[model samples]
Target: WQVFRFAAPALMAGNAALLKHASNVCGSALEIEAVFREAGFPKDLFRVLLIESGEVAALIARPEIRAVTLTGSNRAGESVGAAAGKALKKTVLELGGSDPYVILADADVEHAVQVTVQSRLTNSGQSCIAAKRFIVVPEVREAFERGVVERMKLASCGDPMLESTQVGPLARLDLREGLHRQVRESVAAGARLILGGEIPSGPGAFYPPTVLSEVKPGMPAYDEEIFGPVAAIIPVKDEEAAIAVANDTSFGLGAAVFTRDLARGEKIAKERIEAGSCFVNALVKSDPRLPFGGIKESGYGREL
Candidate 1:
């Protein structure tokens, strides 16, 4: 609700907003519309467009729609951005991320463990900044491995409807299959799977939360983001190597640094991280008070 936390006041400030969420979250979308209506917003003040991806451009091209904001794939953002551009209108996008999570030799093991465990489990690891890349310095690799393994073992993997479930199925069938393919290809490219390599046998589109170790550059997994529960762990020899590996990917969405040395963290935060937002000594999470966006193929513009 962080979004609504700040956006509600903005909405009340006379500027209306429309939301076109993921098709799977229709119920939540409509309920958001209801909240605005109940708050005495004009019927036209808050609109929910339950539209398909194939038709977003047409909707955004409407003469009344002055600006458009979108959150999804880079392809989707390009389409919407192009359409809005053609209309000579403003458009903002919060596109997908292949964010990196880095831990230097001086990192706090327990702190990194707690944060990485929580980062990978956020929104069941379907989040944009959910720590897709786990880069650790060699000196701390074994301890980080042990820490992550212990925590991963503790992650509840079962029905989302269950109160104790920490991991759930991917959002849709295609998402499941695509992530599975990434796993297969990444493994084929010599990436070692310390955890979760196979698909879970199930009726729903469920994929077990997975972690990969010995992730080196040149693998397809390194080149692209796996948009599910799978996390790729990369170990580097030094902080420079870690920074190089972290920035090697095309994505520049969010980058995180976990280290005890505040000076080094500040240096990386200011100079090394190639992202719209960089977090020092913390995992990245979006906020309504600050704008969030991406650079490179992750897409462009901002959203708050």
Candidate 2:
């Protein structure tokens, strides 16, 4: 999606494209290039390079490269942005996020819970803009937690190719291990495991939908981006506290606030929340019509 998002604009603007995709998704990369060729694009105009990661810096530094764009972690973004900067080339980076999904006291609890379950578990929660943090007012904290756990349990976990599989495996075994490490550390740091904390005994890189309650500052679930099917629920006293907690993270990619009062949700989502994209009574998503990016350590420059 990101590859096309940026490539489409560049192609429309009469610029060529060179894609160096993630090693795990090489087939998809080749298919994208094939699609462009079949669509009447000049063969040389759109290309996919199966190059080693070490070769990327030199490629970006080439005079003909002109510009660079990346979608990955902050560490990877820093490395790419630095190389591009040294080459004095334009660059766009879309990095990791720990987006906040706030449920206000006046929110429709059922609606918020359903949308949040969908948003957080989409792509097995591997998305950069997925709502990782759940900040709910004290009045509805227990109800939100219960609803989330019950709803999350219903998500079928198995092979992604199966249409009924709602929660699929992580992209790799290492990614699943890393996510479990975060979950373990957070649990040790006092974040209570509400449901699905155990890694299932299986062959594939599958993990169940896990939820952590009472997550607060100092826990990895609170501070770091858990790029897997894990949910961190943090309870706050009031709206002001909710906003304060939402803005507490270093990454500012996206956020959401659910409230029956549209005016109040708007004020907090548009003005108070510290994120590039904020939604009121809805989930955050990337639309072709809107510019998508992040602020602070998340990334800089827009993609679509």
Candidate 3:
């Protein structure tokens, strides 16, 4: 949010701003309007349309909306993209990622392992760039796998309304269904499980942190992004193989390489990644100033 305070002026310069906030955060939508209104923006110049889902298409197709910016589901991105495409409106999509977290042999063993686990479950694993896949080198694969699984099991999922809850509820019921389906598909495809595949006992949509090893390509767990606390631990022979496994996914939204070797980090960041963004020594995600998007089916437009 701090980034936006600085970035919005530079990016929105000479361009009218149109915002489509997430469905659940209407209060945030109104707050955005208040900010613009407080800035003395003309009523007509800054409009926040909190309309029915069906009405979004009409608004996007209007001549007034010259460009579209979105930070939400990939499915939502497709609908917005279609409307914008039809109306010839420019689109900026900050689609969330099923990002990969790569751990090379030369990576700092303890720090890399700890951060990998943390990144996987950060934001209740709700982040687009929360490290979804943990790709580890052969030498450290067993250690990394054990470390991640242990940490996952220790994740304290409970009431978000609680002060100490580490994991919160899904935004809604349907999202939990989607996550459950993904988990089921992965298991059916024969991926080895490490921990937490079932929903915890609660009214809230809570799944314990899940860990899987021997995640071969083509398995639902390997190819698809598990949006929950599910972790896919894929083994690679060396740095080159790690890069290959990292790039194998349709998503190149972001990547993290944990290695002291700065040169190898550069190579992975420059040559191996298919993502619009890359993180050499840290886990990857989006920011307001730095643009975020993906290649292939992930979407084309960048968000800044």
Best by lDDT: 2
Pairs in clash, predicted candidate 2: none
Misplaced by over 4 Å in model 1 are 1-10
Question: Against the true structure, what is each candidate's TM-score?
Answer: 0.93, 0.99, 0.89
Q: State how far residue 297 of model 1 sits from its true place (Å).
A: 2.5
Cα lDDT, all candidates: 0.81, 0.93, 0.76
Better of 1 and 3 by TM-score: 1
Which parts of model 2 have CA positions greater than 4 angstroms off?
none
Which stretches in model 3 have alpha-carbon errors above 4 Å?
Answer: 1-7, 10-16, 35-46, 161-163, 287-289
Alpha-carbon lDDT of model 3: 0.76
Better of 1 and 2 by TM-score: 2
Q: How well does model 2 score by local distance difference test?
A: 0.93
TM-score ranking of the models? 2, 1, 3
> Pairing residues by index, what is the TM-score of model 1?
0.93
Candidate 1, residues 1-304, lDDT tens digits: the string is 6336435755767677777777789898888888878988788788877888778777778887777767778777778889889888787677778888889998998899888778877877888888888899989999998888778877888889899999888889898888889888888889888787677775888787677888887776677877877778898989899999889988888988999999989889889889989898788887767877778777777766
